[model samples]
Target: MVTPTESIKWKRRPLSTMGQTYKALNFEESVLCSPTQYFKRYIPDDLFTSIAAYTIIYALQQGKSSFNLPMYWDTSLKVNVFWENISRDRFLELRTNLHLVNNLEKPPENKDKFYKFRPVYTAIRKRCSDLPIEENVCVDEGIIPFTAKFTAKQCVRGNQVHGESMSSCCVESVLLFQVLKSQGINAVGTVRQNRFGKNLPFSDDKTIMKQTRGYCEEITSADEITMCKWLDNRPIVLCSNFVGKGSVDEVELWNKKHHKYVKVERSEIVRKYNHAMGGVDLFDQLISSYIVFIRSRKWSCV
Candidate 1:
């Protein structure tokens, strides 16, 4: 079996067609945006700091919260970090019964883990819950690198284009949903389009999302009929880049059309990137744009 850790180590995992265009965040920005409290509860400070460093970079590259690649990459690496510090036997024990580890003993000093990262997850979840909830959830898709290498034979559904391993952009979507679900928000991940005919990691049919896991309501733009069900009950939370200030109005129009409003959250690590590259003007146009994007949307939590 391909352990999660090994999966993250392979940078080629997420089809490297783009030459690292997604720059990482800088140190100051990274330090400023601390990890959620859940991480502090279990992961040791130093180790957690390292993990946070990588995760912040990963999150920035992902552009927003996600699952497809970044989610797996984060989990896999933490798993590896844990295994490397502790023996395989102990690792298996914890993997089998994570709760016990949380309640009974301290994590192995050398190993790092995110399995019971309730604090971080909780923080994110708590923030999401505070947001308005609705019945009809909106689902969309965006593309990001897989951070791994897979050949044409491995994609399972899409055309096997060389170099890039076509994978679902679920990391950001799922992360948002995970947080929402924790707060009793019934949302779902729906596929807007499938340029390539590949099965989603959690889906069985390319035509519709396979509702197999998680509590959030799942739908795909392809399933227009089913999607309407969420119109009144689940408010839409579309995941995309901060196109500009106009995006907020666009979301409002969308809400008015469906009797629900939309909330847009921009997740870019330019500040982090600038810090990583040691750039000043830490308060330059990029940061200002990000701030303006957040303020315009009234996304107070950001």
Candidate 2:
């Protein structure tokens, strides 16, 4: 029998199988598109693999203009090996025909919106599942900017760019939570205030200042799921199964009246939430700073 204190060990392996699966699915989609076309002339599996690698490298190497024929020209970037190997026409052809999953088959009702990128989605989820769970795991949402029309696209108000509103679950946040709990990993996250029902155990009459400065409430369900709600500028709520209730810490808060920073007693839940909630946001920020400016209709490619 496994002890509660024991950690789960993850196996490390190459993701070549995922690449092979992608190639097969993409080739099938391409074949289905042009069944009458000559098989001998069709793009080979090796060429597709090369194209995938080239695309990733191109995205990494930034250029003045977006990914276009001109960007890969000799005059623009001298002695470019990638551009010389693949012709412009062939690149465009592959880009146009690339497909992750077959559209003919109807997806399940719940996953219909995300059917287009289902293959890539599944691959990512599998990769996440294979990773070892950390003792302290944080969950948060990250938006993928996609102006193109897609069923799963969500428009977040106040964001400068319009795009799909993917929640933390896209990165397997909920799955990680469940898995980590089984291994005794602590998980914390800031959830939407409205997620709580109207019949909250805590009173709604609390002032915003009182809540934001320092206030914590512990809630437990019949199933023994421990959740916490604390006040800090706004109502910050979290669900942490491993953390104990009533733990407090001192945090610095700005006082508008006195025009100085004041130390206030804050709950441990608030401190942990503030410290751990930025993993996804930090990732989004880093990618946004250096992301390739290429535009695409496909949400997955974007």
| Candidate number achieving the greatest lDDT relative to the actual structure | 2
Question: Using alpha carbons, what is the TM-score of model 2?
Answer: 0.59
Candidate 1: tens digits of C-alpha lDDT, residues 1-302: 11221121211111111112233333232344355654553444655554445554444444634322311223455777654455554433323322311322445563434434445554555655654543232332222223243232223248432222223234332334334434543332322423212342322232222331111222222211111111222322222121101111111223445576554332122122222322324424444455321112111322
TM-score of 1: 0.20
Pick out the ten consecutive residues of candidate 1 with the lowest summed lDDT.
242-251
- Relative to the unseen true structure, what is the C-alpha lDDT of residue 125 in candidate 1, on a scale of 0 to 100? 57
Model 2 ranges with Cα > 4 A deviation: 1-79, 101-112, 158-161, 167-186, 205-212, 254-259, 291-302
Q: What shift in Å separates residue 213 of candidate 2 from its native position after superposition?
A: 1.7
The CA-based lDDT of model 1 is what?
0.31
Span of 10 residues, lowest total lDDT, candidate 2: 14-23
Clashing pairs in 2: 211-231, 212-231, 212-232
